[model samples]
Every structure is written in C-alpha cells, then in structure tokens.
Target chain A: MRKLIVVLTLCVISSLALVAQGTPLPDSTSDSTAQLLQQAHALYERLDLERAVPLLERVLSPGWSFGMTKAQRVDAYAYLGASLALVGSADSAARYFRAALERDPFTDLDPRRFTPGQVAVFRTARRQTFAVGARQVSALRFDPRTEQLSFTVVTTHGATLRVEVRSVDATPGQVLFQGESDGLREIAWNGLMADGRLAPPGRYEVRVDGRSRLLSRSDSTRVYFDVRHELPALEDTLHELLLSELRPERYPPSAATGDLVKGLGIAAGAFVISGALADGDLGSRSSALPATVAATAALSGVVAFVWRRHHAEAPENVLANARRRQERRLTNDAIQRRNNARIAQTILVIAPASGVGP
Target chain B: MRPAFAHASGPLVLLALAAGAPTAAGQWTVQGTGVLSVMRHRVDAGYGVEPSSGVLAGPEVAASLRDRLTVRLWTRSGSFHADGPGAIDRDVAEAGLQVDVAALRWLTVQAGTTRRTYLTVLARQPWTTVALGAEAHLPFTETGVTGIVRGAILPGVSVNGLGHPDLAIAVASGMEYRRGRASAAVLYSLERYRFAPSATATVERREQLAGLVVSVGWSLKR
Candidate 1:
C-alpha cells in the first residue's frame, strides 16, 4: 500500500513539472534568463546549492519580469524561495514568496514541499519587490599580503555593476573590477590594477556602482595600501636616477667630428704657414726670391681658403655643447672617486670568486 | 747685436696670446715648459779635433685645441769651442704644429712640421723640417714617477730647397714626475745631424750631440 502511495506521489510530481514546462513561457522572456533558469533548476536537483542559489536568486530578484505569465512568475518565486530557504534566508525567502502573491493572489505555496519556518515567515510578507529592501554595500576585508579585496553588495534586485579605485577627490580614477552581480552575495578582488600591477602604496577610495531598472546607486570604501621593498632596491633606484641625470641628454656625434676635422685643417694650415715663413727668412741665401714668394703666395692662398670656410652652428647647439662641457667637468677622476666612495656603503656586492680549495 | 729680443719676443707673444686666448674661449689649453740641457758634441770625421762641450737652454710654449692638435713655439741657444780655433755655435728659434694620435695606453705617435731660424755670425738661416715621432711611457711602480722614451726622425726636405738638407734624428730617455697637468722630467738625449753635400759645404758632415736635459711643465687646461 505504501509503495502504491509513493508511486502516486511520484506521478503527481512528474505531471506538475511537465505542466510547468508546457505552459508556453512568456514571449518576452530573454533567452539568457531562460537559460539561467534552466541551469539553476538542474544544479538544484543535483544539490549544487553553492552554484544554484545565486542563479535562482538572480532569476527571481532582478531577472523577474512583470511581463511574465502568472505561471512563469510563480515558477521563479517558488524556486527562488525554496533555494533561499535551503540556504537559511528564511525571512528573505518568505519576502519573495509574499512578493509573488502580491502580483497574483492565486499563487500556490505547498506546505508539504516547504519547511515550516518558511511557511511561518511567508505569512508575514507585505508587498512585491518594493519591500525587498534598500541597496547596501560593505567591504568585508582587505588582505595586503594576499592582495585580496573582499566586499558584499545586497540589492533588492539584480543590478549592473561597475567598480573603481580613485583618489579621495574622485579624480585620478581607474576601473578596478566590474560585472553583473548574478546574485553573487560577495566579491573578492586580487588587488590588481587594470594593468595587473600591484598598485603603488597610497590612500585610495574604492567605489562600487549599481544600476537596475528601478534605481541606481553607488557606495565607496577607503583603503591605504603600502608595498615595502628592501633598502638596496631604493638605493638602486636612486643610483639609476642620478646616473640618468648625469648622462648626456644629447649625443651630437657629428658635432665633434666636424670640429675635429676643422682642428686637423687648422693644424695643417699652421704647418704650411710655418714652412713659408721659414723660407722667407732664409731667402738671403739665394736669389730664388720670386719662386719663394710664389710658394708663399700659394700657402697664403690656402690659408685664405681655409679661413674663408664657414662653420655653421645653431644657437641651441652651441648652448648644448657648453652644457656637455660642464657635465664632462663633473666627471673629474678625483671627484668621481670621492662620489663613488660615498655611494659604496649602500652597494651590495657579491664576494669575488676564490682560488681552488686546498 | 742679434735681435735677442726678437727671437725671445715671438715665442713670448705666442705663449701670452695662447694663454689669453684659452682664458677668453674657456676651453683651450696652454702648456709652458723650460728646459736646461748640458751637451757634448763630436765631429764625425777629419774636420776637427777631439770633442766639444756646451750648454743649451730653451723655453717652449704650446697651445692646443683639445687633444688633437698642438702649436708650439720654442727657442734654444748653444755655444762651444772646438779644440782648435773655431767655435761650433747655434741659436735657433722655431714654431711647430703637431698632430698626435694615441697609439696605445702608454704610447703615442706624432707628425709635425717645424720652422727653424738658425742664427750664425753672418745671418740667420731659416729651415723647415717635417718629422715623425713616437713616445712611450712607463710607470715606475705606483709612485707616480714615469719613465719616458721619445724618438723622432726628419726624412723630408728642407723647405724651399735652400736650408740644411740633412736627416736629423733625435732620441731621448727620461724619467718624469707628473701631477695633474703639470710634469717635471730629467732626460738624456742623443741627437745626430747628417748633412748631404751642398755647393756651400762640399764634404758630407755628421755631428752627434749627447745631452742631459732637465725640464718642467705646467698646463693651463686644468
């Protein structure tokens, strides 16, 4: 007799499920929401509450539609309420159940299917979504070592969300994290900036923004994070900065080349002039005066040619050359030695290789 | 009297201008040096008796544009009596330009030309010579004292084809003390002048002079 009764109950449950499925869901149902509801139901049957509860809550709270048929609406509310009750949100479950009845008084709640506490709590429901509650967000905790930032957002319904880290003045902002809550009660961020870098240590405000059909809201939390490095690293950074400053800003390789060529030409000019001058002084030894004078004239012509040659340098280039000279003077060996001595205290050096062991 | 002032003044003015020029330009270099040398000379063949001894002293001032080119003006005079009636004497004033290339860490090669006015009792005969020279330096321990070797040979013509047509070879070995751009050296040198036969002097003549030279230098670059 018991077996027969159990079989009858099974048949009734199967028909109820079929009837729900065959009811021609609302034409306005978004394919996405339909898929989510189907997945939630499957997970609930498999007892994957960790995954199913959020999906059911998402389908009910924000995914719920006024355009849905009475059957569809009842399905969302009943499933969401059952999921919430299973997760121990008895009061919230009852609230959703009452919200359904407010829309359609003929809503059915099976006592045999739901816990006694859920039934008792359901009796206290007053209105639809309006009574679900105000939107609230709180930062759970931040762990600097793990770089994990955790937070919770409770919304009366599903919301599109955006998260950011910004200066106290709300300027210098960057997006930190964002997503549809998908009924997720908690969020954890690995404390990475958009570029996946651990943000430099400073005071910054974390902002969470939510927008739903009925309302839009934002909440902020302040965090000050510090990243510490060894003294050697700081020293190395300073050394590099100083080295960079000491480096010549402009390398005018061609500038010196032309000057060097000019110098060579000048030396050659001096050489020939010296030669002609000597010849003129010794002209008394022979009557080769005309020949010597011609040679002298030729040398003079060369000198004139060299002297007439123009050297063009821009005004800025001249200044830059002077600046480079000054920088070069700064590297006098003695001064460099002294500066190196002063900095050597902080330079970490590995021991040199020793001779073979005895 | 010889225009001792003229001979002295030209180099003096060059040095003054070189010194003043660098000071004005703010980056040129000037180096002044004074050398005192004791010399002994030998006549290579039948021309004279034994040997002669003399003193040579000079001052050199060089102006440089950076590290590449240098213009140096110098003057030196030496007088000595032979065993017989005559004296072998020379008083010279010259200006030179050198292009130096550092060939190694402790060595340098230089090429240059010199205009030399050789003073005689009759007149001053000027000569031009081009030379290739090499210099090597060695540190004596870490005490900042350096040993130096310098050698040069003039193989080119006497300019205008009228002056001493001789191959002049000079070599000096020295020890120097240097600090910054200033240095002091005590040197010994052997200098040889081999003259080709000319219309005025028929016989080929070779004169070799060995000398001890002491010099001190100071630079304006620093």
Candidate 2:
C-alpha cells in the first residue's frame, strides 16, 4: 500500500510539471484554443521554447477544433516566432513573423518580453512582407467644430499610404491623409464630407492602402463603423400655398357678361318703378327723370362690359398674390435659418460595425 | 315747429352714437359722407296736381361693426318751387335713422325711422314713418364697384291733420365705386303714397316724390 501511494504522488507531481511546462495534453472537448495559447504564452515568458513552440503550433493547426479570436491567433504566431528565434532557427522565426505581420501590420514585438535577435527577425520580416491595417473603431462621440474622429493606421514598411473615410456604397468621401508614411500613423477627420458639409450618418468604411517603397508589393485593408447623428430636431420649411390662400389674378370669362346683366337689371328696375308705381293723377311721371336713370344704367352696362373685356388682368388681385408669396418666402427663410443653426450643433456618434462592405 | 325740431333729434342721437362707436371686440368702420340731392315732388288731394323740383344737401354718418351690423344717420333740407304752373312752393326738411343687420354674405335686413316736414306760407306739415327693408349688394369682380338695390314699406306712418295712407312704398337703385377709403355713389330713389277717400275729403289723396342722389364718402377703420 505504501509503494502504491508513493507511485500515485509521483504521477500527480509529473502531471503538474508537464502542465506548467506547456507539454501537449490530451485534446479534450473543454480545452479551448485560447486556453492553449495562454499556456504557450506563459511558457514562452519563462523562456521554455521547446514546449511553447509545439503548443503554439498545435493551436494554429488546421485540425484544432476549438475556436480562437483573431487576436488570439495573431498572438500564437508572434509567440511561435519569438520561441523559434530564441532557439536559433532564424529562417523559421522570420517565416512565422511574416505570417503574423500579414495578418496584422500593427503587430509588434515588445522589447521587454523579447530579445534583440527576436526583434531583429520581426523587423526583417516586416521589410520583406507588405501589409496595411487600421485599428477597429471604438465607440466615441465628438463635435466636429472642436474635436474630431480619430483612426490609427500602419504600414509594414516605408510606403505611400492613402487613408479615406467613405460610405459603404462608394459615394464620394473625404481623404484624411495621403502621403508617404512609415510604421504607425494617427489620422484625424473633422466629420466633414468632401463638399464641406457635415458627413451624413450611415455605415462607413475606413480604407487604408499602401505601396511599399522597398518592395513591389501593395496591400490594402478596410475597417467598418457606423456613424449616427446626435443633434437637435430640425424644422421643416412651409409647403406651397394652397389655392384658397391666394387671390385670382385674372377675372373669369363670365364676370364681364355678369356685370352687363346686373346693369341691365338696374335699368329695368328704374323703368318699372317709374311706370308701374307712379299715379297718373301725379301729372304723368316725368319721362325725363326716369329716362335719365335708365340711360345712365344702360350706358354704365355698356362701359363696364367693354372695360372688363379689354382689361383681363385684375391689378388688385395680382398685388395681393405677390404680397402673399413674399410673406411665404420670408417664413420659409426663417425656418431654414433655424434648421441650419440646429445642424451646426451636430455631434457625430461613431461605433464599430460589421457585414457592411466587400 | 318745436315738435318738428324734437323729431329731428333722433338722427342727431344716432350721429352721436356713431361718433362714439364701440370698437373693442371686432372690426369697426366709420364712414362720413357728403350728400347732394335733386328731387321732384307732386301732390293731389281732390284738387289739381302740384309739381315742383328742389335741390338739397346734407351730411350722413355710418358706423359698421364686423361687416355685420351698421347704423346710419342722415339729414337733408332745401326749398322747392313751382316747376309747372300748378302752384307748389314749399320748404322741405328730412332726417332719418337706419340700422342694417347682415343676414348673409351679400344681403342685409334693415329697419329705419324717417321724419319729413313741409313748410308753406300758411302752415307746416310733418310726416313720421317707420320702414322695414332689405338691400342687395352686387359686387363687380375685382373692380371695386358695387351695385345696390333697396325697397321698403312704410308700416307705420303718421301725419298731423291727415289720415294714414293705405299704400306707401319706397325704392332706390344705385352704384358705388370705392378706392381705398374713398368712395362715390349715384342713386335714383322714389316714394309713393295712396290714401282712401275719407269723410272730410271725398276724393282719394295721392302723393309721390322722385329724386337722384349723389354722395362722396371717406372711411376710417379699426
């Protein structure tokens, strides 16, 4: 029984040693690739290249079932390169470094965690490989007047770089920077379109393209984000005036004929009153008196008809309509002024997005 | 004469009211008009007809509220002489107070009181009448011109030393042209009365008056 207990203790101690040294354990359903990367990274920190390299390679293998984040995968490749460089395999180390750089041009070797030889191998890989990258946008809010939206981009080597923020549909966009760039660069945008108006809110892409001066290779990268406006509500201008609001500028065709009829009616009324109501005993109603009114009425009728026919335009109505239109224009202009003021206070709200672009 | 002067006080009271017209609630308009009138007068009371013509001048005041209610006061005075050799010569004075209430956009119902006094070389005759009427306004499209027609019946008429007439009516037709606050108007008017034969006078009495009136007016609004 004593010998069996001693053998059990030895087995437990050997397992603990193997786990700490990052020795490949039996692949289990619960063992995630990220957990394996952490173990390998820990071994690499302790300068255990022999165990760390094999564990990192196994995590990156095609047969690995566990899912790993992009950051975790990049970490695995970087650790493999560092471990291989420490073991004096310079060519293999450079190959892994190039792979990591291709996945992420912003990848770098921490001088505190890596030796000069490992860092030199990473730098040599960067010179040989061409890659461009932009950091994923973090959630932020800024006013265009006093602050700006910031983006971080990188080139693997000295290269001509162009960084632009554009809508996903390829509408004309603003170029943040276009010049020779080396290493890491922070580009800023003032939330304006190429036409100097506030950038409309929608899904946008921050595209970075680079052409390496040291090599014939070129690379491009895209990072998508959603832009939304945080602003005061804007007012709408007045619509066109309705017909009832405006006076008719021209008289209808019936108006002239109607006036003629009205005048004739007046003449007939006078004649009826003089001839029918007047008593003959009152010495025969003065024909001159009644005739005076009838003639005046009939003449007025003729004159009105001729005047209305020749003058089709109603000047009073034209003036009234013009005044109404001017009043409407003034009202709409006031509304537009208020809307522009509200838009000037707009705040750009930016957040990371996916599934937007090719 | 004292009673006739007292009867003329009705239009004076209306004129005072128009001068101090209330304008606190709705739109108010006040108009002042200068009137010139030409009249032909005749009378037949069991005798030969007497005919005469006269010219009169007067002032008229009107106050309107909300284009809905209106009050008017007017007075005219002149002398009539024989136009034919029928022996008619008298001095005439008349005053009236009228109120118009709009029943529709283009129609108004009116009530008024009129007092007319005739003075001959021997005596004075006074006639008091109450009238109910309707007026129609026809506006010419966009021309600032309006045609007016008015008819009224004298339901209550009283004259000293005379019986009430069996039939009495008045009618007028006119045209008005308005530009801004200034306006000019020309109107033809007629009044007729027929009285039944009475015990004191054996024959029916008939009287008629016809005239043309022209007025110019200025308006103020608040």
Candidate 3:
C-alpha cells in the first residue's frame, strides 16, 4: 500500500514539471530579456500597446522569467516607459524612465525613434535621477608624444564631477576633468603619470565621482583597463667581471726568493761546467771566461732580490685591471643610452578589462 | 769567407725575413748586437800540443717573432799567434746561422750550421758542420735579468784535409740583462773535437776552443 502511494506522488510531480515547461513561470528563465524587449518593440510599432506593455513590464519585474545584461534591462524599461506614456499613464512612464537613467546616466531617448512626449519624459527622468558612470575603455595604441587616450563619462544632471585615471595600486593619479559637468562629457588624457612621466604599463582605472548640485545625493563609477607598452626590446648591461678574470696586482712573497735562487743557480752551473768540461791539455782553462758570467749572474741575483723586496706591487697588472673596469663601464653606459631611446619610443597599448569595484 | 758559408747562410736569411715580415698580429723584434770575444785555440797530435790565443770581434743580427721563434746570423774573424817556436800562425774566420724555437716557458730547441776557415801562409783550410742543441732560461725577476745554459752536438762535420771527428761538442753558460729595448749578455763558451786513429792519420788528433763572449744589443722592434 505504501509503495502504491509513493508511485502516485511521483506521477503527479512529473505531470507538474511537464506543465511548467509548457507554460512559462515567473521564476524560470525560458527567454532572454533582450529577446522579450525585441518582441515588445515589434508589438509597440504595430500599435499593440496592451500586449507590448505586459511583455516589457515582465522583463523589468523582479523574479521575471528571463535573464538580461544591464543594457538589455535598460532597453526593457525604456520601451515599457514609452508604451505607457502613449497610453496616458504619465506617472508610470516617468518612474520607468528614471530607473533606466539611474543605471546609466548617459541613457536617452532618440527623437527619431520615439514621440516628443516620450523624449520629454526621458529628459525629466534625467533631471530627477542622480548617477555617474564611465564608458568602457576602447582598445587603442598611440604614442604618448603626440596622441591622447579618450574616456567618456556622464552625470544625470549638472553636478560637480571629477574624473581620474590611476593605476590599480590606488596611487595618486592625474585628474583629466573636474568642476561642473552635465550629461555626457569627453575627457582626454596624454598618457602621463602624475610625475610627468610616461605612464608605466599596468592595470588602470578610470573613475567618475559626482555630487548633484540640485539633490544632496552623490554617485561614483569606475571602469578598468590594462595598459601595455609597445616598445623595442631593450638590451641588458654586462655583469661585473669576476676576480679570476683580472690579473693579480701584487706579487707573492715567494717570487723574490725564487728570483734570487734562479740567478744563483745559473752562476753555479756556469762554474761547474767550466771546471768539468774544459780540457786539461788546453794549458789550463781561462779563469776570466767563466768568472765574467758567474759574477754577472751573482750580481743579478742580489739586485733582483732587493728590487723584488722593495717593489711588492705589480704596476703593470694594476693598470691592466683598471683599464678593463673602465671599458666595462663605458659599454654599460652605451647600453643605458640605447635603452632610454627605446623607452622614448614607447606607445601605450590600452585595452578594456573587467573592473573590481563600483 | 768561403762560398760554402754563404750558401749555408742563405736559408737562414730567408727564414729571418719570413719571420720578420710585417703582420697585423703578434709582436716582432729585430735586434742588432756587437759581439766581443777572447778565444784560446789548442791542437794535440799525439806528439805535442800547440796553444794559441786571439781576440774575435763581429756583429750579429737576430730577428724574432712573438718572442717564440728567433733566427740569428753571426760572423767573427781573428788571427791566432802560436806560442811555441815551431808552431805555425794561422788566421781564423767563422760564420754561423742558427734558429731557436721556444718549446716551453724556460726551454728552447735550436738547430744551426757553422763554417770555419783557417788561412795560413802555406794553405787555406775550410770546415763545415751542422749542430742540434737546446737552451734553458732561468729568469731572475720581472726586471728582465735571466741566466742561460746551452749545449749542442755536431752531427755532420766536414774538413778540407782531415777525417771526421769521433766526437764534437759545444756548450755555453751566460747571463743576460734587458732594460727597455737594450740588452747585454756575457757567456763562457767551449768547443771540442776528437779524432780516432786511422790508417791515413796514424796519430789521434784533438782540438779545443774556449772563449769569453760579450754582447751589446739594440732592438729595432720590440
């Protein structure tokens, strides 16, 4: 009996799900709000206000059976407001128009597409709603020397507004526009940092903050972008020379003794060879011959020992090392100059990026 | 000088010119040196010994490339006066060409040829020889003082009126000092020749020459 009861409950739930799929539900997204707005626009063009009004109102309603982008939602509110205005519901039209204006202060009704009454209603909505917003950054690359990066910002009504371009690090950035601004205003930036240098490559934000002069309300909005530098590849400087690369500047202590020993050894060799190799029948060896070389060698030994002892430093090696260091410095300086010139030719590459904050 | 010496000297002059030719790489050095030597000459012919002495003086030119290879040509002429009453007086003239190749920092391998002529009232005699040798350098210091020892063996010897010597040897010990481009050296040199008894020459003959050689050099290129 329990199994039969559970089977009947499952059959009822399956039938309800099929019915829900066949008939659109308020909480189920069966169509995009953009598509619904398009349908309403077609209906309103045919003068079917009763059918278009319901469709556009459903798109703007909370928990409505559709999803939408910010632009699509704004389009739905605009169409609903225009339809109601033509039907003589002036208060309802004004309310829907203000909702679109609060979302995007640059929102407007085109006179070619809408009646004069609807355009007037949009203007009125703009005056009542207080909002500030920045347009998406366009992808562009321009040399900072001549061209500029442009940004579009708006205030719903005349207000004291400030627009700033800064890095994502929240560093003090350059203010492109300030003072009273109403509606849409184009701001230009020369791609320079606050310190009058070319803007370094990084993520940057374009922020617009305004306080309405008529109302005591304020609004702020920001858009993010990535800045890249389009420049020639820079060369790297050579590294410092190691100790092994340079010649020794001082002679070792053993050098003096070694010199002395070498001289003495030569003197002894001359005497030994003269005594051992000379023929006895040659009427005795000439003492003067061997004595001259021995004396010179022995004297050289003494002189070398004294000279090496007094002059411990090797001047030749020191001079060579200094010249090497100077050469390295000159090469590095040339590299730095080339790198600076390449940096001067930098072109800022700007592209829109997803923002992190309002 | 005998024509034989001029022929032996030809290849040495050519080699020196080749080594000294101007090149974009390596260092070249040409040094001209004045040589002064006092020589003692002795001859033994089984029965008696004849000793004589004389002074030999001449000029030598040396050309080196990169301090690694050197070529030298030298000539010295002098008269030897006999000490004994019956011995004959003779004039001696010698010329040599030599090449030295540095095989290591302190050692050099050498090959050379020498020609000697004895001019007497009775006859003119010529001798030609080829030798292989090595020299060892012992540097005293960075100031350019060096000690040198050299030894050579004559493998080919020819004499106008005598048989080949059973043994022929030459050796030298010296000291050299160089400052800037000027250099000076003093060396003790000895040469000996021994001939065994033969059918044509019944008596064993021996000859020896010993000398003190001093040189002053100036470098054309360093």
lDDT tens readout by residue for model 3, B1-222: 333343444454344334334444447688767788888788887767888878877667787888899988887777788877546788887898899999999999999998888777778878899999999988764757788999999988888657889989999988888887788998888888888877767888888888788988777563
> Which pairs of residues collide in model 2?
none
Residue A58's C-alpha lDDT in candidate 3? 76
Question: Which candidate would rank higher by lDDT, 1 or 3?
Answer: 3
Stretches off by above 4 angstroms in model 1 are A1-75, A78-152, A155-358, B3-28, B41-46, B49-53, B64-71, B78-84, B88-92, B122-124, B157-167, B198-200
Candidate whose TM-score is highest: 2
- In candidate 3, what are the lDDT values of residues A275-333, reduced to their tens digit? 78777765666677788788887778878788889998888779899999999999999
How do the residues B51-101 of candidate 1 rate in per-residue lDDT, one tens digit apiece?
556676667777666655566666666554443345445554455556666
Residue lDDT tens for model 2, A132-211: 99999999999999998889999999999999998887677788999999999999999998998888989999989899
Task: Note the chain A TM-score of all models in turn.
Answer: 0.28, 0.83, 0.81
RMSD of each: 19.8, 5.1, 8.4
lDDT of candidate 2 at residue B146, scale 0 to 100: 75
Under CAPRI classification, how is model 3 graded? medium
Worst 10 residues of 2 chain B by lDDT: B1-10
